[model samples]
Target: MFSPRACEGDTNPVLIPFLLAAAAAAAAPPAAMRLDYFHTGDAREERFALDAVVREGPWPGPPDRRLDDTGLGRYQFEVRDAKSGEPLYSRGFASIYGEWETTPEARDRARGFQESVRFPEPEALVTVTIKKRDARGVFQPAWSVTVDPAGPAVDRRPPPAIKVWAVMKNGEPADKVDLLLLGDGYTVAEMDKWHRDAKRLADTLFAVSPFREHRARFNVWAADTPSEESGVSRPSDGVYRRTALGTTYDAFGSERY
Candidate 1:
C-alpha cells in the first residue's frame, strides 16, 4: 500500500542570534592592504666613491643617510579608532650584509668592536588614523620614522669591530666625495681582522692606477660601529620594506659597480 507517512521531528528551536552573528562575521571588511615602492627610485644618493684616498688610519662615517624624493613607496593601512591610535609600544633593528664586502679574516676581526652606527631618523611611525566614517572612504594608516637623537647605546656584548675605507680615483680628501660605509656586528677576533681588512681594502684600491695616482689626494675613515644598536632594517609589515633598499633605489647597483 502506497500510503503517505507522517515524519517525527525534535521540538528544540534554533537560536536566531547565532545565525545573525555568523552572517555579520562573513560580511565584515578585510583588515590588511599592501603598498609598493618600486616607482620611487630617484630618492637615493651615490654615497660611495672607489677613487677616494685613505690618509688617516681609520675614518669616521657620515652622520646619516638622508631620504630623497625617490626614497619612499606607495603605502596603505586600516585603522579601527583614531582616539586609540597611540602606539602600545615600538621597536626597531639594523643589519649589514656580512657578505656584502670584506674578506673572511676582516669579517672575523670586525666582530670585536662596538661603536655607534647612525641611521636616518623617522624610519616610519603611525601618523594619521584611517577609519570608517559617515562618507565612503578607505582606511589607511599614516606613518613616519626617525633616527633617535640620543645616539647609539653602547653594546656591552663582546662583539667584533668593523672598519671601512674609501679610495677615490684622484687623491682627494674624504669630505670631497659623498660616502656611506655600512657594517655588521662582530666578535673581538673579528674586530682585529676587520682592521686588517680595512688596510687590505685600501691597498686594493691603490693597486688600480687611477686610484693609485690620486692616492695622496683622497681621504679614508672608519665607523667605530654599526648604524645603530638595533642595526638597520625596514619597518615590520611596512610598505617601505622592499621599496627602501632594492626597489626604490636611486643609485648603486650591479650595473654601476
Candidate 2:
C-alpha cells in the first residue's frame, strides 16, 4: 500500500486540518473516502478486485456536485445508497489500464494496475459500481461492491513522512477547484527545487486563458515525498532508478504523456 500524502512533516500547516476539524464538529461536509482496487486483465477480458478503503481527509469538492453527467472517459464509477439505490456520487475517470489494454502488449500478456476512486464518505452502507464503455460507447456496469462508512475495514492510519503546503489558497476547497501537485522523483536534498518546480507549474497553469481569468475559483496544493532518486525512470533510454513514487516516462510509447 502506498503511503498517503497530506502526510506528516510540515508543522502548523494551514487550512487542511482546520477544515477537517470543522467538518467533524459541524455538518459542513463529509470526509473524503478513497477506494483502491486492482484492475487486471488483457484486451480480450478484464477483472476487478477490492484492495482497500481509506479515509483521506475532508472532502474538497463541492457537496452539490455529486454526479458527473458529462459521460466522459472510458470508465465511470457510481456510489449509491445501498437500500434505496439512490445515486449519491458518481464520476467518470480514465485509468492507466484503459490505455494499457489498447496496446499491442496487452494482446500478448495480461497486466494489472492499482487504481483508486475517491468520493465523499456516506453516512451508512453504499454500493459502488464501476461502468465500462462498450464497443458502441454505451456505459454498462462492470463491477460492483458494497462499502460501509464506519466499517473496521476502512484504513484510518496517518500519512507518511511528507510535507504539504498551499501554493495558492482561494477560499474553502468546497467552493473552489482543488488542484494537487504531487512529486514522484525527488530526493530530500531536492525539496527546495521541488518547491520551486511546484510554483513554476502553478504559474504555468494560471498563465493559460481560462485558468488565469478564473484564478480565484481554484486552490493549488503541493506535497513533497523526498524519494531516493531525483529523476523518474526512463525505460526507453535504458535508464532506471528507484523512487518512492513509481512514475516513469515512455508510457504507452509516449515521451511526455
Candidate 3:
C-alpha cells in the first residue's frame, strides 16, 4: 500500500532503456523488499523513522551486481548480514528530502518526506544503514536499523491489484532490463488512450540512439490507476483534482517539477 511515486525522469522514455540495461542484469533475481520510511529534516539536521516494510514482487535485476559501485546519489543505503557483517546488497539513490533540505524553506522549518528504498529480499536478518553525503562529498552514516525478513511486522501482502502489461518483452524479466511506465491523471474512460500513449512513448525511446541498437535487451511495462477526474492538480490555475498518483505541479515551489 505504500507505493512510492517514481521519481522525476524515471518515466522519461529515453532514459528507461539505458537504466534498464545498467541496473538489471540478474538471471534469477530474488523478491524485492521495500523499506518505507519518513525522512524528516531541516537545513541543520535530519532524522529517519521506519514506516513499514513490504514485499514488492520479484526483484528485476542481476543478483551479482548487488553492491552499487556507482556513487551517483546524495544518499546511499546498504543491507548487511547481521551475523557475518558482510554486505549483502547496496544501492545509491536520491530522495525528495535530499533535494528539499537544500531549499531556503528548510532553514526556517523542518519538513518530512515519505521515502522508500528497494533491494533484494534477504534470507536472514540484516542491518540496513543509510548514509548521506557530507559537506566534503564523502558518505557518512546517517541512520541504521535492523530488519528481520520473516518478522511478523513485515508486510507480505501482494502488490496492488492492477493490470501490468508489457509494452515490449525482450526476455525473462531477470535477464533483461525492465522498465515500468506508471500513468498518472488518466481517467477510466481514457484507459485505452493511456495504453496507446505508453506504447508511443516506448517507440520514441527506441528511436533514440544506443537504445535504438539494443531495443531487444529491454522490457517495458505499463500500469495505471485511473483518476476520478482527468489531468493533474494545478492550484496555480485554480484547477484542483485528486488523482491516484497524487502528482501535482509546482513541486518545491517550482512549476516545472
Each model's TM-score? 0.25, 0.85, 0.84
Task: Please list the residue runs of candidate 2 whose C-alpha ends up more than 4 Å from where it truly belongs after superposition.
Answer: 1-24, 253-257
For 167-257, candidate 3 gives per-residue lDDT tens digits of 9998987678899999889999999999999999999999999999999999999997899889998878887888999888888788878
Which ten residues in a row are the worst by lDDT in model 2? 1-10
* Winner on lDDT (2 vs 3): 2
Task: Highest TM-score: give the candidate number.
Answer: 2
Error (Å) of candidate 2 at residue 216 is 2.3
The alpha-carbon RMSD values of the candidates against the true structure, listed in the order shown, are: 25.6, 10.9, 14.1
* Model 2 steric clash pairs: none
**Candidate lDDT values, in order:** 0.32, 0.90, 0.89
lDDT of 3: 0.89
Candidate 2, lDDT over the whole model: 0.90
Superior candidate under lDDT, 1 versus 3: 3
Candidate numbers, best TM-score first, in rank order: 2, 3, 1
Q: TM-score of model 3 relative to the true fold?
A: 0.84
